[model samples]
Target: MPDRHVTRSGDDYAEAFSLLLPQGQAWPRDEGSTLMKVVRGLSQIWGVVETSASKLLEIESDPRITIDLLPDWERNWGLPDPCYKEPLTIDDRQRALVQRMTIEGAQSREFFISAAAYIGYSITITEYRPFMVGLDRCGDSRVYGDGTEPMYSDTFVVGSIPVCNPNGDPVALDELSEWPNYGLGPDTIRHYWTVHVHQARLTWFRCSGGQCGVDPHLRIGLATDLECLLRRWKPAHTEIIFDYSGLTPGDPMAGTP
Candidate 1:
């Protein structure tokens, strides 16, 4: 399997991770087919990134940076926005529709590149270098870079889905105004949201930790275990620490070395 590993270290912490994709996953020959891959990747990637990064703001959709690569056919019919709080249910027909749309969107160079950047960046603020093609390099290209399939060597299968506590209802946007700032009790800041992916055909967990509606320390442990669980399928970079030795106002929560 073709794979790469990333390691990050700073004052308070140090960790290593990797992303494993099957070796040389080929692109489909048909133009339409390729586009479908893009769509699926986009939706799955968006769903995951949004759920993982929601602690920054209480909003489900961040207007500043978001991408959807749905095809015209699917778009015309109307597509459901991926929401953290909402459960996604699709019948066989709806599943097929989404599958087709995802493939088409994946094939589009602009969409693919943009989605990659967004997901990669959202993973962590830590510096990461994944095998990515820049948009400028793909400028004006009617088709994707040569019909060659990207090489991938490793894959991970999610063993089980994370179960959220039913008692924890989703925090609505309207409630944000009344929501306490500064810091609410750990229980109030933390909640679990699950995301289901079609390609991997797996359900994964996102534990809100660190200023979460729950306990920060518990969140860190869950996040760590989640990363370890993902390692069962593929290599992934996790737990990034920022270096601020020279800065006057360092992260107080980061802890002293």
Candidate 2:
């Protein structure tokens, strides 16, 4: 997910795709689009979902230490903060839903439990950590109908949580130029995909037990721990968003005429 860069491939060719719907497509209006809708539209090919509970284990108490650790933890990772604004406060329903998800996700893996506990321990000592992390959805658009069909493919990363400003100053069509394209395809019409997701990171640490506990190599241990967890956890696709409105709800994907 951190690898958002478009790399050149065979014969210096590269491409990406996106799905956009014309106005007047059908779907009921709500406060906003549901998380299920966004998650379902992603490509089914390859994705990495490192839950908040899993990451919670890597942090420790002490704001000073975490502040110091931030730069190092993020070394070589160029995660862009395109919004340049603070997180909007999610309503109680959303908060409860997120907490329930983290808890249930931890139940599936002991490592996630350990990670969640570690974050809980750190939160008792510090204030900057988030309660949840990494709510994302991505799918392979190159194939369709349970991935049996093959076509051009593309990948996208959600930059931030979806926010609605019903009364805030309207962002003009040209104003959206600043946001990075999902980089779907060279021809721009060969394939289509869409994504909207949220992510957070907390820090904590513990032990794996065994030998070398006396002078354990922290970095190596951490790497090994993450690798093992990734191997065992695989997310199953549970939903899909069809119909053109999924590409852009409430408004035509093409924007104002």
Candidate 3:
């Protein structure tokens, strides 16, 4: 019979409570000691209790008071203004999932759809504008606009097609490419795209048609357009899994270890 050996990395037992350690500091040498193990176990239990309590408290707590309790690092990590953030990516499938998972009163479904569409529009335009215009005329058109209004107006030109409506069906690029002056000069396609994204963002986050109400904490601005804040649309702090992991120690959560 062949010999078999089982091995476990220290990270295998790690829990969210472990984040209590300070950043850049190593776990104590006694970290694996019996007492420390008990502490770790208790910390994990406390974390679950804490999370439940927070959710319950959130129902009645003043948002401002709750905001005050967040760690300074989380508060300061990204751009201060929502208007400058990039749009979140839009995926109908993901939005459906969000609807199923969250309470209906939260209206998370609409939020997901709007955020995704907004971000997807931003990314698509940011990346494909040069290709759509060809490299030569790319610099001729304005890349970034002052955060006042959408770059493209309703009548903005994109070859033979006039982008008459920001929320209309997407124009086919093949048809656009066949136009006589297709890539010869600067065009307003990028601006039109921004308008589409802006509309989505506004629908999701705005409390009133022209006023702010809901606090979108996860949204961070990469830049801005006229009346729209561009934000990264993806979920914040999602962990990407990598192969060959037994256990990997992560950064500490709080004060020095």
Highest lDDT among the candidates is held by which one? 3
| 1-257: candidate 2 lDDT, tens digit per residue | 23233322321210111123323435322324553244334422222222222223333121122322333332323211222132211121122223333543431223333442322210011001122223312432221212211211122233432211111122232232112222333433212222111111222122321124333222111122222332333233212111222221222221110
lDDT of 2 at 157: 35
For 140-230, candidate 1 gives per-residue lDDT tens digits of 2112122223311112123321111121222232221111111223432222112111111122222321223332331111122223222
User: What TM-score would you give candidate 1 relative to the actual structure?
Assistant: 0.13
Question: Comparing 2 and 3 by TM-score, which wins?
Answer: 3
Cα deviation of 69 in candidate 2 (Å)?
A: 33
Worst 10 residues of 1 by lDDT: 11-20
* TM-score attained by model 3: 0.21
RMSD of each: 31.7, 33.4, 21.4
Tens digit per residue, CA lDDT, model 3, 1-257: 11122222234334444566555434542676664586566656555665555554662132222233333322443323344344332222222223223423321223433443433322222111223522224233322222322233222354433221122323332222111123323544222222223221222332221123434523333224323422333223221111122222222221010
Summed backbone clashes in each candidate are 33, 18, 21
